[model samples]
Every structure is written in C-alpha cells, then in structure tokens.
Target: MKTKKFQGIVQVQYEQARQSIQTGDLLFCSGTYLISELIKKASNSFMSHVAFLFEWNGRVLVFESVESAGVRIIPLSHYVTNYNNTGRKYKGALYLARHETLIDSSFDRTLLQNMIGKAIGSLNRNYDQTELIRILTRISLGVGRHKENEAYICSEFVDQCFRQIGIRFPRTEAGFVYPEHIAADPHVYPMFEIVP
Candidate 1:
C-alpha cells in the first residue's frame, strides 16, 4: 500500500528555522497531537501550545507546561525543529513570538533569567487537567473556566513568567487566554516558520 504522495514529504531541520532569536523569546507552537487537534478545532487557530525561551550557559532552551510531561525544559533547537522519531526528543511545528519593547529595553536581563530559572526548577509539575476540560467546555458552550493552580497549562506558564516580573497582560486570566490570543497579542509578532 505504499504511495508516491507519502514519499514526497520532507522532514524538518534545526538550522532552517531562520531565527536570529535572542536569549529570551516566546514561541507559539502549532502541535500535531490529538489534543492539539481538539484545541485547534475549538479555538479556530493553528496554534495550540505556547513556550518561552531561556538562554543558559551559551545554549538556548525552551520551558513550557505540556499535557504529557508537565513543566519541562528542552533544547531550543528541539523546540522549533523536528527531531527524528528514532531519537529521543519531542518535535512539533513551532511558530515564534517576541515582545519587542522588552527586547529593546536591554535592562533586567539577569533578573528575568533568574525568574525563569526558578520556574524551570519547578519542572515535572502537573499539567492542568481541569484547564483542558475548561477548554473543551468553551468549545461547546462558548464560555467556560475553572480555577487554576497546582497544575499549570501552557499559556498559564508563559503568563506566569511575566507575572513574576510584575508584567501582567490586560486580560490576565489563565483559563481565558488561549494560544490564539497569545499569538495575536500586539507585542507578539510572528518571527518565522520552522519549515516542518
């Protein structure tokens, strides 16, 4: 049952992302999981996941809350680009976003990195199962939410990083902020496609 169409597809590579990304950048990821499909269907947006970047010891990494692994850190290269399934890695279609205002200031770099470090240390925490249900509910009812804590969702985790620095978004509700809103935020602009 082999098909010529299936063989025509090309795999992705790390260098192809074309990012001149700084130490700290926010990445909005379009996922391929079954849950991602549900999220995309609900939000009517290509993005389903959100992650933030951190540079440590000259290597860049991304930190986020994922449904399966909870809060974790992976090499930035792995975040945006494809990883051969034969190897040990997590891969997805990653789109990037950054707040130029913060990037331009060039102040508080150490403090920001320190805060992200603390959040990273909180890894292996639980992903918000309630939030997932809330997202599903919003899809059906067009309005739904549950209190957020103990477990963190992707957008919540990204928001918390800013909250720690006393930078709160205007509509700062964890359950209400979806990936689409994050991607559409005025400060966040599309960087480039990862070529998946």
Candidate 2:
C-alpha cells in the first residue's frame, strides 16, 4: 500500500504568506542562541522553539512563551524583522506549518474563541524554566515526567491552546512534549519557511 506523504518545506517571503496566515497556524523556529543549541541537543531535533499565530485587528501576531520573556503576543512582522526590538532579524529560520485536520475542516467558532481566550488569559505569566529543565532531565534519564502546572515553555503553551480546542499532540514515552514532537505530528504539515 502506498503511504500518505506530507509536503516538503517551501521557501516563501513573509509578505506572500502574510495574508493567508490564519489564527491556528504554527511558527517553528530553529534558533541560533546558546539556549537554542542546548534545547536542540536535549530534544534531539533541529527545531528549538515553536509558537502559534493569531490575527488581531487585521494584523497577524505570534503568541509564544520564551525563557527571556514569558507568555506574550507580538506582531508577526515585528517578531521576524525586529526581533526583541533589537533592530535585527531573528537569529534563525522561521517556518510556517498548519495542522491539516484543523485547517481543512470547519471547526467550531466557540471552541476557537475559548482556545484564544485561554491563551490570552495566560499573558504575562512567567515562562516555565523549571519545567523545561525537568523535562530535559527526564528525557536524559529515560523516565517519565510529572506535570509542573504553573508556567509554560513554548510547545507546552501551544499544546495547552490546542487542548482547549480538543486537539492533542502526540507525547513522548516520558509523557513530555517538545517542538519536535509537534513538528513531526502526522496531522501537521510544513507549509513554508518565512524569509526576510
């Protein structure tokens, strides 16, 4: 039997995909920072971080939790162009992905609103640095992890949002989830790499 195949990464400029980018689209980052390298090594994947997108007042915004800045939303253009407001671009590649099932189907509006509400409610909460370390340690030890319920890392935050909509990503044997896990999910497909 022939197996279903997913699309390979397509390179596209931000302006090209900007209009079509929707509320639930994903942004995956392959950062070039020290912490990014550490995460890459620990997770055994190239992608070090992940975030989701949403539109507000006709502007697309990225919603994510980072070690430096907790949960927050920033204009997608600002995020890719003047990252951290440093007048320099992000130090890595950013790719756009979509959950096929979610994007293809006509999902409930109320569910989406609830999901966005949950994410907004988490704004300014501290990034779960402890959870990140605990997850990495658990992976290293080949053991399961205990839920740290307080704050969130990028993928976990995104996972929680999807959970609000009744969609769950696959987890590791240790019951941990990472950007790589979300990237490799069968239902999610790479659309394009957003370029400068």
Q: Highest TM-score, which number?
A: 2
Q: Name the runs in model 1 displaced over 4 angstroms.
A: 1-13, 16-19, 80-92, 170-175
Give the clash total for candidate 1. 0
User: Could you say which candidate leads in lDDT?
Assistant: 2
Question: Residue 8 of model 1: what lDDT?
Answer: 24
Q: Give the C-alpha lDDT of model 1.
A: 0.66
lDDT of 2 by residue, 115-139 (tens): 7998999998899988887887886
Task: State each model's CA lDDT, in order.
Answer: 0.66, 0.83
User: Per-residue CA lDDT of candidate 1, range 1-196, in tens?
Assistant: 1111212234344465434656557776666778887787787766778888776776777888888788988777654443433353344466655666566676676668655865776698899888878877777877776575767888777777777665554332434667666666766656655553
- Cα RMSD for candidate 2? 3.0
Q: How far is candidate 1 from the true structure (C-alpha RMSD, Å)?
A: 7.0
